[model samples]
Target chain A: MAHEVTVLTAGELRGLVQLDLAAVDVVERAFAALASGTVVMPPILSMAIPEANGEVDVKTAYIPGFDGFAIKVSPGFFDNPKLGLPSLNGLMILFSARTGLVEALLLDNGYLTDVRTAAAGAVAARHLAPAKVETATVIGTGIQARLQIEAAHLVRPFSRVLVWGRDMAKAEACAADIAERLKITAEAVADPARAVAQSQLVVTTTPAEHPVFKAEWLHPGLHITAMGSDQAGKNEIEPAALVAADLYVCDRVSQCEALGELRSAIAAGLWQGGTPPELGEIVTGRHPGRCSDDEITICDLTGTGAQDTAIATSTIAAARKAGAGSTILT
Target chain B: MAHEVTVLTAGELRGLVQLDLAAVDVVERAFAALASGTVVMPPILSMAIPEANGEVDVKTAYIPGFDGFAIKVSPGFFDNPKLGLPSLNGLMILFSARTGLVEALLLDNGYLTDVRTAAAGAVAARHLAPAKVETATVIGTGIQARLQIEAAHLVRPFSRVLVWGRDMAKAEACAADIAERLKITAEAVADPARAVAQSQLVVTTTPAEHPVFKAEWLHPGLHITAMGSDQAGKNEIEPAALVAADLYVCDRVSQCEALGELRSAIAAGLWQGGTPPELGEIVTGRHPGRCSDDEITICDLTGTGAQDTAIATSTIAAARKAGAGSTILT
Candidate 1:
């Protein structure tokens, strides 16, 4: 049988997909499907290349109603910056759900991952953040720091943004970029605790091996989205913060227990409540996300294959409609 | 930094690689690397799409000293034949071990998997099959049946082959194909027991849920390579047959126990010996493969990710040298 696969470059994907409300809705639907318990997502297959200081993770999910499923390959090489390259990049391959044939190769160079991840934060904020927000804080100086702030602004029209990082210069640069891009008041804060205390919503986006957000800073009406702890040995929130929060949610319960803030919380003996509700449950209205403005909420976003599948599926559809990629016959 | 990936179609891969001695050697080296204990191979990530009567598996391994590693995606839709589509088709993506950047996209549509799987059979026969073999039998009239006979011929130089299957007509067709392809005498036998008793080497390649090769047919100096059982609930050899053999080896012990013939053997309470030696162990000389020609041997080939990495690395290298694929820069 003749087979054809559409190949989209990162440049084309950037033109096709953005961190907009539509992207947020697509990811939100994925969470709802995940809540339906029909999404088949396996644990990630990861390999570490110690010699090169690199690691690669393969993730996939099969959503029942989707026309296609996506298998995403993400690689993180810490030392790549030394070679004047970004530390993280990879691609996703979409296959026909019925025929199991190749449909598209999404060479997004981690752009889709970035958008999906940030959109997940937006979903969390849309469901769990305070009704009124004047200030938002992002605890990192990475690409996600900017994206998370932009995503949060889409849900909650926060006027002021604070960027916090260990490196003050990078933080200042990031804050400047956000200010120029969003045309809002943005500042680089030296202290994360003060930033969290003042902001109504906080998003952590660092690859820190220790907590960057503290429990003492988590105040009433504040929602924290911790997204950097997607791998073992990485943490961005204090374990006690989960215990202090009125409602603690996860992207996926099992994944958070292994690779999210819940791991550290369990390890520190701070998490006594077993199996927290997932974001999907909240999205499906099975669990109330935030009952009151005074309640402190935290959402652990470890990212998921369902999000990748949803975003890839949507991106390919858009690409096909726009005729944005080259097709190769096999 | 600019990134480039080579995309090789199945036709290009077929032109670059073949079911030959070199392929066998590459697979043999992978076995050796696996036994060395440095190959980082994660458990396969699989999902069942019951709605489509299909299943997809993602397998990857990082073998040290290799420039690249392959992540192979294999999809099997059992009902595809009705739609005039092959049941199995997929692709592999090879990534740079150093930079974690994609090196190649192998659109082989399961062709490389076929060659590597057949080469593994040849590796088993080379190590376990007795010398001076005049007749060999294949216990299925599938693609692997012909490949197994041809692969074994590369090692044992078997003069005659017997093809056995449930359908006599299909068996005769496979036998005729093998006879014409290899220029050797081949026959289709209805009696599986008689075929086993007459042959010095036998390779079972059926996806039967129950045992297809009986223990009573075991004869001295016969080497049985069971390559069919790579998933749970699929067994080709009777459980008692494992106990009847003098020596039993595996491509991978844990995989075999879960997905290969050994799963049935253990369930039948017949496998008393704990943790049998692997094919890699035999390749590395850690275990004597065949003590004597009179000893009955069984090697369970459940396949491995290491072979995929090895074959993919070699294929890409050959493709690069031959300039056989299109390169896309991202």
Candidate 2:
């Protein structure tokens, strides 16, 4: 019972993995599996620690034909910034589906989560966004904003990138970082509306309590991927913009209805009483995605345990083949 | 951060831990924390695999003022024995409460679960059972049957032990093992009623879907600890027997009402309409346990997350102090 369990730290994971379009394909397949009703994804177990302004969520999914399942414990302590600590950190425990034994522990400190989230955004953009883009805008200076732009590049190559944040200095720094990382002309933009109107693609990656941009900022043929509204009361897209969109898709309709931008739209009395097709349906050829360039398309990604499992499974496999992680008996 | 986490395997844990009366006291403190509204125990996340006749449950509790919290993944594959594997297997992942970091991994393979369960049974008996006992009966020749009898020895010094099982060979073997282990005059008995009539205490531990003993088999001063019905449909004590008992309690009143002996009684329309005081209440001095020797007492144990957290925290502390287990960066 004291068999070796592979242990991959965040730095080790970051060194060994570069999640790009190919990783998006992995997430797409996971979405298809979830849509096929062959995966067992339990409702998240969430606990709140109001005293510390923190919460932890446990998510996992057992795919019918997969070799491993992942149980991810993601914690967010909103007050950690003042203490010189990252607000988000957690680990994933991967188990063998056959024997239910611990296969690996990914103490990635949310590195894998960022990778999967970015990959999921790329997958959605690939299936739903416009084919060509001269300009793109990212509404946040956080880690996800940079990752989303990188992920969005896998779907649509953009020349000029507009970065926005509450703090203009951080926004300028993020723009410099984006320009260096993606090798593009990136600039900090204070006007969210102007940035939105100039770009064909918009990715909002903020923990905003209100809409990131006004609904009127949406332009023709624009596709948006809102990736920040995974929790209740978090909104990165206006409700009116969602109603105005021609095709609305989400990572998981149930999750969206409960904790995503869809929940906000529903709360605003703007959403129609019909379930939109999930992103998986489009990926699996069950529904048409991005019918016309003029059609306003949006994909609400509230995240899924399937993506977590998919990424964890692939990470462990890659780490083992590369001999990138240490092993210890537990 | 690649901090070290103590890893405790099943064999190592078994060698170091003896969960008897003292362990019961540990569990009692956890129950007190739970009852005092200081522990954050979330609803269990459960998933089922119909094809494998299996289910996995993730349970956790964050006790206030504790150093760490434990998330336990308990999976039961009913068809495992066909492949030379036990039906239940899983591990606990303990996280530091302050930083939400990995503290330890207890790969106990259900050893800790079994220990906590036996300790709970002992706690119940210590508070509710008759003080003096010449004989005690245990139904079912499973691992729990052995553990429960050993656990019961902490509260009452029985001179003789009776073991009953459906299979005569297993029953006789279990009795012989008990005699050798506990050094009591033990014998296998086919007649559960006859065994109940002679013994002052009864501990039922089986995966029985039906009642093990009838209500008519009960005698005055008989105290029973039922430890089998943890699922919704499994019962080892008759509803009538529960109704006839003078005092009744369970590890958790809510859990008992949903999946323990109390559920069976309520289904049969025999339970009185009120929440029976929990064992925690009695342990916390809020409720009187056994008042008279002639009054029959019964306690049902459906298990709790608090006990898991307590045991895991204590185990990790001990392992660190004893320099046991392998440490891995997570």
TM-score of each: 0.99, 0.94
Q: Per-prediction DockQ scores?
A: 0.83, 0.50
Q: Across residues B1-330, which tens digit of lDDT does each residue of candidate 1 receive?
A: 568899999888889999999999999999999999999988888889999999999888999999999999999999999999999999999999989998899999899999999999999999998987999999999888998888889998888999999999999999999999999999999898888888999999999999999899998999999999989979999999998899999998888999999999999898998889999999989998899999999999988999999999999989989989998887
* lDDT tens digits, residue span B1-330, model 2: 456666777778877678766677788788878778677888778777766777777888888888888888888888878877787878888877776767787888788888888888888888888889899999989888988898888878798999999999999999999899999899999898899999899999998889987889988999999999888888888898887888888888878888899998999899874788888888888888889999999999988888899888888877777888876654
Query: lDDT per model, in order?
Result: 0.93, 0.85
| CA-based DockQ, model 2 | 0.50
Q: Write the per-residue lDDT of candidate 1 for residues A192-245, one digit (tens) a residue.
A: 888888999999999899998888897999999999998989988999999999
Q: What would the TM-score be for candidate 1 when compared with the true structure?
A: 0.99
lDDT of 1 at B149: 85
DockQ winner: 1
Worst 10 residues of 2 chain B by lDDT: B1-10
Candidate 2 local lDDT, A1-330, one digit each (tens)? 356778887889887767777688888889999889788887888887666777888889888888888988888878878877788888888877776767788888888899899999898888888888889999999999999999988778889999989999999999999999989999999898889889989999988989977888877899999999878878888899888888889888888998899999999999984998899898998888898888889999988999989989988888988989887654
